[model samples]
Structures are given as structure tokens and as C-alpha cells.
Target: MQRVIVRSSRGALPTAAKLVAGIGLALTGFFTASAILPYLPAGTRDQGAGLMSMSFGWLIGWRVIGRAPQATMAGAARVGLRAALWLALTVLLYLGALQMMARMLRGRYHGLSEALTDVIAQGLGLGAAAVQLDVIAMLFLGGVLSAILSAWAARRWQ
Candidate 1:
């Protein structure tokens, strides 16, 4: 394989913007957890990944509504890609925090293989202290609806 160098021509993120985004993302997780966890079935309430749906909603809300709808096809596609990327970033941050909390609460985890197995099993066995897809699926749908409403609000008020 050949190696290639990559460089960013665009400037680094502004300090104030970085601070705001970090605080916003952190708050998103906290807000989502506080608001949604109690309503979830007891089995999957602790899994913070579910918070991504709420994060997605808030991120997409601004991205989708902030952009002008009259853009060219390519521009629209670019906006969509950015929206997807925002969701991915949100998921990573939220899950990373959750994993750290889990480790702190549970003490040291086992080897890599065991950790992976535990994650998979937790995903499969919500009734036994793990994540479940069904809950996430519903949460994601709720997020989409939330994004739409937020977009409407953004457009109407801003």
C-alpha cells in the first residue's frame, strides 16, 4: 500500500465555537438521559447510546432548518452528508461518556475479547442489564419528529 499525506486547508475550529459545541453536546446527553431514561423500560434505561437519537434530533434540527431549501442538488447532498456526520459525532461522544461511566461504576473491565462479548451480550439481553435495539429504534423515530418540529421552530422564530 502507498502512503499519502493529508492536510486541512481550512482553519481550526474557533475556541468559542468549540467550547459551545462541547457544552451543548454534553448537555444533550444529560438532558436526554434525564428525560428519556425514566420512560424507557427498566431493562434498557441505563444504556446511554439511546441518547444519540435525541442528540441527532437537536443537531439535525439546526442543520436542516438553517440551510436554505433553494440550494442546488449538490449543495443539498452536502448538507445531508454533514447532517449524517453530525449524528455520527454525537453518537461517538455520547457512547464514549457512557462507557467511561460504566467503567467507573463497574471497576476495571476484562480483556478486549471479554469486553466485546459483554457489549454484544448486553445489546442482546436488555432484561439482563444491556442495550436493546427496539428501544433505540423507537427513540430514533421520535428524534426525527423532534427535528422536524425544531426546524419549523427555527425557521419561524429565527
Candidate 2:
């Protein structure tokens, strides 16, 4: 079984570029969602869901690389780590852009406390523990979506 897995991964070597492109495409999707969704109706955006989706997509990319023909478990792990790094970079860039936009449009954010409160509200809502569960569930759903896509890409590209 292990040998079979190894052989399958080995066959996926030529698709590295494809994998990278897919990740890029996924990130583009995430940014697009983030930029446009916030402007919609109050309940429509669901920032927690968006975050979850991105996280899932990132994991999908990792799994795709892992299942590639030439990839070993270690290689797959590395791919996952790299994907995570890229995800972090993407988040930082997005947040920075948001801050810059906010500064230009509004002069300043009211303060850190206000920002924190807003974040908490978005993630945890007004209800007690229910909001937290919703956020977690949304995030999990996002991850599942990402993993499915990544795995599909890997299989298709191979």
C-alpha cells in the first residue's frame, strides 16, 4: 500500500506549476469574496464563513500536493507548511490593504478597542456561546471545501 502511494505521488511531479496556479486562483477567489461580500446585506457577508472557506482551500492545496505522484509524506507536509505561509502572507496583505483603505476613507479607526469589539462581534455575535460555535462550523466548512478542491485538482492534474 505504501509503495503504491509512493508511485502515485511520483507521477505528479510535472504538475507542480499547476498546483501553484491553483493556489493562486483560490487566493484570488478569497480576496474577491472578502472585498465584495462585506458590502452586502448584514447577514450575507458572514466573515467567519469566509475565513473558514479560505482556510479549507489552503488545506486542500496541501492535500493535493501530498497526493501527487512524486510527493512523500514529508513533501506533502512541506507543501502544507508552505501553503500556510502563503495563506498568512495573503491575510497580512489583505488586512494591510483594509487598514490603508480605512485610513484614507475615514481618517482613522475609532480606536483599537472598537476594532476588537467589532471583530469579536463578527466572530462571536451577541449571543453567548452560540456565535463561537457558528464561527467554528463556518471555518470547518471552508476547510472542507478547500480540501475537496485541492484533492480534485491533484487527481485531475495527475
Candidate 3:
């Protein structure tokens, strides 16, 4: 009988670059939320939105941007853009899901399919309503800056 050896590969631990990127994006998320929160229709604004955005930004920064392959400044910028989009989409979906869950709790949605549909619809609506020049500019600038900083940190620390 032959014994076969199996080895599992664990990924590298998180680095300074990840931390820097996460912090950068987290601030970006918080500030962007702040920029738009005031404009939300009365009674519909949730005070926790900024915190939620920060959480999403940190997560995406650590998981998406941080895990991306190290590259040139331009490449880092691209990665940052992608990460930013992911963060935006994640926040949107979460907001939508929250709304759907609230409706479900209220017995507003009669079927699972309807609830799912509502989630998408709500997300689109939220995204549409949230679109503003300040928000876009902040996200774009923040993402690019964070990415560049991340790249620099990677090179500096590694």
C-alpha cells in the first residue's frame, strides 16, 4: 500500500498595504455617505448608512483590492476602480436586501420571487436617487488615491 501526502496551501497573511488600502477606502465610504445623506428624502434616511458604507469599503478594500496582484501605478488604479465599483454594488445590494427584509417582516411580499424582485428594484431605485456629482467625484478620487497608496505600500513594505 502506498501512502500519498497531501499539502494544503494557506494564503499569505494580510499586510500593511491591505491595512492602508482598507483605511483609505473606509474613509472614502464614510465621507461619500455623508455627502449624500443630507439629501435623502425626509424620514427615509438611516443614520447608520455611513457606518454601513465604511464597513463595506473596508471589506472590499481588504478582500478585493488588497488581494489583487501587485502592479504598476496604472494597474493599481484599475484595481482600485474595480474595487470601488464592487463596494458601491455591495452597498446598494445590502440596502435593497434590508428593504426587502423589512417588507417581508411586514408581510408585504407574498412570494419569494416577489421579494427577490423587490430587492433588485429597490437597489436600482436607491442607486438612481443617490447619484450626484459630489458622490461620484469623491468615490473616483478616493479610489484612485487609495490604490496608489496601496501600491506604494506594497513596494515599500515588501
How far residue 77's Cα lies from its native spot in candidate 3, in Å, is: 1.2
Q: Return the candidate ranking by lDDT, descending.
A: 3, 2, 1
lDDT of 1 by residue, 1-158 (tens): 99999886542322332233333333443454444354434434355454554555454534442333212444444443444345534544444445544654676665666665555444334322213454344334333333343334434544
Query: Please, what is the TM-score per model?
Result: 0.37, 0.35, 0.86
Q: Which number leads on lDDT?
A: 3
Name the runs in model 1 displaced over 4 angstroms: 1-48, 109-158
User: Which whole-number lDDT from 0 to 100 does residue 109 have in model 2?
Assistant: 59
Superposed model 3: Cα runs more than 4 Å off = 1-11, 45-47
For model 1, the run of ten residues with the poorest summed lDDT: 13-22
**Top candidate (TM-score):** 3
Residue 131 deviation, candidate 1, in Å? 17
In candidate 3, the residue pairs with backbone N, CA or C atoms under 3 Å apart (3 or more residues apart, or in different chains) clash, namely none
Off by over 4 Å in 2: 1-70, 108-157
What range of 10 consecutive residues in model 3 has the weakest lDDT sum?
Answer: 38-47
- Winner on TM-score between 2 and 3 is 3
Superposition TM-score, candidate 3 onto the true structure? 0.86
